[model samples]
Target: MPAADAEVLIVGAGPVGLLLACFLGRTGIPTILLERRSSRGPGSKAIGITPTSLEVLAELGLVDRFLARGVQVRSAAVHADEDARPRPLARLELGGPGAAFPFILSLPQVDTEALLREALGRWPAVRLREGTEAVEVRQESSSVTVRARGPSGGETLLRAPLLAACDGAGSPMAGLLGLRRRVRRFPVAFRMGDYRDESGLGPVAHLYFTRLGSVESFPMPGGLRRWIVQATGAEEPEPSFEKVEAQVLARTGQRLDPGGRVWASAFRPERTELERFRAGRVVFCGDAAHTMPPIGGQGMNTGFADARLLARVLERCRRGGENLENLLALYEPYRRTGFRAAARRSRLFMGVGTLRAAAPRALRNLLVPVLTRPPLSRTLVGHFTMVNVPYSTLSGVLARERRLRLAGEGQADEASGG
Candidate 1:
């Protein structure tokens, strides 16, 4: 009932939180985004932005900025590792005339964050407070309050009608809300690094499924290419340029020149989802809500979808003076269903590459060529690009809202006409 610090308080200034704040600000909703990190770190973890997420960026009028800076990867080539040489198995063409964005935009995750931050400058109502971490979250009957510790170690209390948790997989807000999480860890681990593009791969992404392990290569923007290799380890291994070069040469016969290496890291993949995306006045978005293996590049794009829909639903609720909780309640089921579908897709995508055995790998190499041709290739492209994901009926809810608005406008016009 009383005045709050902002209409909405967003915890985390990652891609999801930044985009959500931008969307809310576009609709005239005041928002405050909090980031625990004092500065942006260097990494290109999530690089592929699906066409569906591109549509959302286009709506925000920020797609051109991304397109101008990103690499348009139009296809991905799957190969069979034959001894030290890789034989082409199948190639997936990713875009068509029917699609608004025919190709996936491959940009560094850090660059993506920077672009989002730059776009935030247009939305004066959205405030990004870095080095401010949410220490405590309290959701009352009418408002949600958060106690944050600033860079100076001073604590500040902020309140809002709504709080969005975009704080990532290890989200503290999820813990503060006492939400249950379901986690499943995969047996696989991988090492990936960016290097100078010397394989003549162009903008095509390449995947080599060998008897030893998988080796994936994707082209990047600045004359660099990303290489990911499945590691043989019971524990997570620290990545070295030597490991990458040796494995890549052994599996694909393409030697990586270490002189042009950038950054390298190792990770064990896992899937995590919250029991629910919301708790009273608080709601989870981005990695805070769900996370899958980074294999398919679905993690950040899924969060982009979350921010897109949340923005529309929140704007509708505020403009129509609707019950915020009830509307959000309606929004959650759709997102949950969408996340489940995305998780399954991510699993399938990762599983295909991690096939180590000979029998299954042989079968895959045989079927991939057939599947990546003609009618079937269309479906494969959809799955790879994430354009085929329905993201549930959240769009239908907004569509109904649009129809109601048009009807109301027509009624007002009739009443005004003598």
Candidate 2:
């Protein structure tokens, strides 16, 4: 294939890759997105899109359609105990008094991708090939030729000036590019699922912290809800509708299987982050760059935002230079700092949630509340929302807090509100 035929090739059509293609394609950048799977698999994971991600999607002009098919989550609450009534942890003013969409958006990852692909598919310049797996990726100074097993097992070669690996945690492109990552294990098993619960759980997201583990539930659209349980026994994989009954009984004190199950899977929370996000003409995106425990519910949302930011940076560089030297330098340090900071927090979160050790537990119960209070909590939530990310995330939080506090004779305004 000729070099002109290759502009940008993305391996992975998950939400991150689809988001990148949609954003870049909207700008008339020709891009090809490849997915190993031929179709969208059935399972509901990562439906929690924080307030900051919602803002990002809106800024990209893709939120309206997403919101049309998604639900809004207004608050998240964590209880001292599982059987304890849920208490509010963070109040998401997605549609702040003056904000556009101040609540968190809830939609299955499948729905999110479907809408993104549907939108991006409208653009003639964007092409998405399913049933295509990258057999090899050869990166040179000018371009990379990614050989894919096309439909019916024949090889399809794509030559692209830039290739971004959005290929999830076990990213094949990351392995091919010789990018080594550090993986830290989170010692716990979590059972997650999408189910229907008619019990009035109300507006807040719930996180119940017990010595055994943590279980959380968030209300979503389509009369759907999500529940995650912290498990201790050697149990079945992809937990069944019956398995959630004990948890539902424990949380609601009502009955068995109050909710009809939709999807279920067992996961171990672990953090995997690459030392560098970019190399030569290729770069990493989403889980290909960093993987974190799902505790903070930041995994998919963070990846999606990464795709949005990275695509813009890549597009800017594409306009200026054929060589991505400037782009790599600009993107690396920014992403490294982010992944490092996220890894640190994820480790702490996993350690706390699992609570296998006593010292860490004591330290956690004490530190978490302190960390979540006023300034600390606001900063953390800002990071979680990706509002303090890239540009104005923490800057705005600090700025707004300072302005409000400075105005008060004896009180900090954001502090008081927080």
Q: What does candidate 2 score on TM?
A: 0.83
Per-residue lDDT of 382 in model 2: 57
Clash count for candidate 1 is 0
Which lDDT tens digits does candidate 1 get at residues 1-418? 5579999999999999998998998888989999999986666688999999898899999999999999999998898875657788888889966889999999999999999999999988999899999999998988999999999999999999889999999789989888989999999999998998889989999999888898989899999999999998797678778898888898988978989899898889889999889888888988999999989889998898888878887888878977766678766777777777788889998899889888888788888999899898888888888877765335676676678889999999999992
lDDT of 2 by residue, 338-375 (tens): 65666566565555656645566556656666766666
- Supply candidate 1's per-residue lDDT for 404: 82
Off by over 4 Å in 1: 82-84, 397-418
Worst 10 residues of 2 by lDDT: 86-95
* Cα-based RMSD of candidate 1: 5.6
